[model samples]
Target chain A: MKIGYLGPKGTFSEEAVIKYTQGVENCEVVEFNTIPEVINCISNSLCEEAVIPIENSIEGSVNIAVDMLINDANGIMIKGEVIIPISHCLISDAPVEFKDVHCILSHQQAIAQCREYISKKFPNAEIKATDSTAQAVLGVKSKPGVVAIGPERAAVIYGMRIIDRDIQDVKENYTRFLVLSQKDGVVTGKDKTSIVFSVPNVPGSLYNALGVLANKKINMTKIESRPSRKKLGEYVFWVDIEGHREDEIVKSVLEELKGRTDFLKVLGSYPKFK
Target chain B: MKIGYLGPKGTFSEEAVIKYTQGVENCEVVEFNTIPEVINCISNSLCEEAVIPIENSIEGSVNIAVDMLINDANGIMIKGEVIIPISHCLISDAPVEFKDVHCILSHQQAIAQCREYISKKFPNAEIKATDSTAQAVLGVKSKPGVVAIGPERAAVIYGMRIIDRDIQDVKENYTRFLVLSQKDGVVTGKDKTSIVFSVPNVPGSLYNALGVLANKKINMTKIESRPSRKKLGEYVFWVDIEGHREDEIVKSVLEELKGRTDFLKVLGSYPKFK
Candidate 1:
């Protein structure tokens, strides 16, 4: 199967795809610039499946990920999810100390993440914002007085040296990405099913729909609502429950869910991100 | 009041602040590059309140916005929300036809939004990525063969001429922002209250919490869950209800909610973004 990712190479998403498809065989990779483009390619038969970000600083695009999947012309499903810890390093073509660096390069967010470190160490260094952190790592060859902030994997991919590690202020940084495919993943026994549904504009209506899971003692992982956009004061709720769509209880709940709301779209059943 | 925004000027966040504070009195706007820093400023007394993007291509930093708010030391609240329609215009120092363009500049996402237009009309034009669309507009000083894609307000702010309008692939483009302040907004007759709470590791714990709202006949607008991040297999649920916290029914719901959950944090009550 061919796997697609958001990339120009040496990105964290590439690492995520690698980590996810580690044991899977016969995988070819395709890259797309935007989330909608990457997911749209799925329904158009450009590739069998792909990995896209739902939340993460690397992508920092949660809403579009959810919005596109909701509005995509073709049906897309979540197959799996991976949470990649964001570890930014000061990567350089050669080892250098903070004083030796005259310029710094990275994506705007990356630079901002290490803003305190940069201002203290390289107070006069020039800061250049690239299209992506990987772009900064790729462009690090020509500047002797420059260091790029990006994933340590980027340094290895570009054959660069790591000047420092974990330069970002937030040590608990992480990005969660979803594996997208034409159909949801097979029952992993431990899976999460995501669904979108709307209800009448009255009290207890949503509570009634949620009762299906509550009745069966299912653990709900997430529930979010976005404007319906078609009309004023209307909303559509997206939910994540702790069971695959194919699971016995989940299947029965979905069937019952159909009758409880205006419409129900079972987005996908995927393995939870560990 | 002093308001904070993500900026270097001529960006969408600036426009959001302007649009949101249109009828308000005595507002000063301060600019910050990062969401955490901007929100942190509120606690530090750098600014009274701020507008930050929750969703939009211009400020594709939704995760940071949500994450920062959930953990902000200052106990920030959502005072209001505004949805800005994204309308990109091709602007330059002087008007230039598609044929006359030698290069196009904008934030990568803005350029991608107009991807099909460029691929069809200016296939050979050099697509340069800048720190932001505003930076692209600012740098258009000598590049007569260049045009930048950004909000039409950029053209007005930068004194540039717009050569083309609405060249993006999607027409229903909109960015949602939240009005953030130290205290929750006033008791507007029509309001939304947002809260974050957790329940014990029991089957119907979450459902029972919902019962409080249902029993009060509150219309819930949004519900989202995020990892409490403090432990494994634990989550914190963020919810939005249709009535102000001060409202009788909603107040009763919160009082009952306190007894039914692990902990509850009333993020804030704010005027609904209409």
Candidate 2:
């Protein structure tokens, strides 16, 4: 199997790909610069599968990923899911004292996850957002008195010294990634169905549509609304429910939802991330 | 009156301030570097009020603005809303044609909004993300063959030439900004009350809580779920309804919601944007 992931090689997404493919026979991984590229590789026949980050506990949904799936489903579907525990580290090119640090560099999301730590530990440090955390560690070689926040893997790969470990604001931070392929997985009995639905922006339209799930006593794991891109206040919702599309109850629920909602698309069914 | 805005001047937030404060006398508008700074100014008493962009038709909610408002209310309330039509322009330091542009610069959100245009016009141009759209325009001076996407106001203020006008992919783009102060606006016949509520991640918790609005026949203008920062799937939802908090139906709905939700915070009611 071949897998594509967002990378400079040392990102958490790379770690996700590694963790998900552990012990799998004959697995090869490719690194792409952006989530869209990582996802598009599957559709473009450049790769058979891809892993992309969908949501982070602290930062919330990765809007670009969700937006792409919502705006254009285009034969892509979720085959599985992975939950990676996020542990951000403070790394520098050389051993340095905390007070000596003058600039903090990392991807914007990594920087956001460590805001409180940054403000308290290095009150005077200037922040520079880089394209990726791995790039930050790599760039710090030429930039003195600069530290990067990212996975410890980046520090190891770049020959940088670890200044601090587990420095994220929320120690329990996690990111949920989706494994995308041309087709979804078969019913495993324990599965999740992700769907995108649209309703009018009127008062109870959403409430009415969600009733299809609530009435059947189906459990909804996640629900998020994105702009329909047509107008302000108009939205298309991405929802995850606790059942496979092949299940009888899930099938009828989707059928009922089609009538209640203006539009509905089933992204896929996948096993729960354990 | 003194007001704070996210600026180096020449941002859409600055334009929103100008438009909202039009016809007012003796208004001193100050520019801050970030959204947090703009919001913090109100609590620090550095400014009487601040104008900040809340949502855009293309980019959806400005997450930083929404997250700050959600995490900490701190006596700040929505005073009013202004809907500014967005029209991104291709700007250059010196007169340059489309083919001469070697790099594209702008804030991530602006770049995202104009992605289609950028990819089509400058397919090979390297993209650089700046702190703000205004900063992108300012930085273009020393960098040869670089262009920026931002409001025309930035081009005018920075003495840059407009290479192309209304270059955004979507022609009907708009951004909704909020006017924030210590207190919310007085009841207007056409008003919007923003409130946030939390429910357990378990099935039907959200469905039951939203029942309060549906039962009262209150029109909900917007609804979005943000991660609770505690766990994946757990969420706190921000909702906007069609009536002022002072209205009897709205008040009753809010009271019922408090009993039904794990946590509820009324973010205050304000006049709806025209």
TM-scores, all candidates, are: 0.78, 0.94
Using lDDT as the measure, the top candidate is: 2
Instruction: Give the lDDT of residue A55 in candidate 2.
Output: 92
The reply for model 2, stretches above 4 Å from the true place, is A95-105, A116-131, A145-147, B96-104, B118-129
lDDT by residue (tens digit), candidate 1, A1-274: 8888876588777888988988888999998754566777788888898887675442233555677776665778888888777888988897677778987878655665676677678866756655567778987896788888998888888899998888776566677778888888888888999899998877788888888889998887666665565533456777788988888889999999898999789889988876
Residue A49, candidate 2: how far off, in angstroms? 1.1
lDDT of 1 by residue, B15-44 (tens): 888899999999989988655567777788
Give residue B130's lDDT in candidate 2 (0 to 100). Answer: 64
The most accurate candidate by DockQ is 2
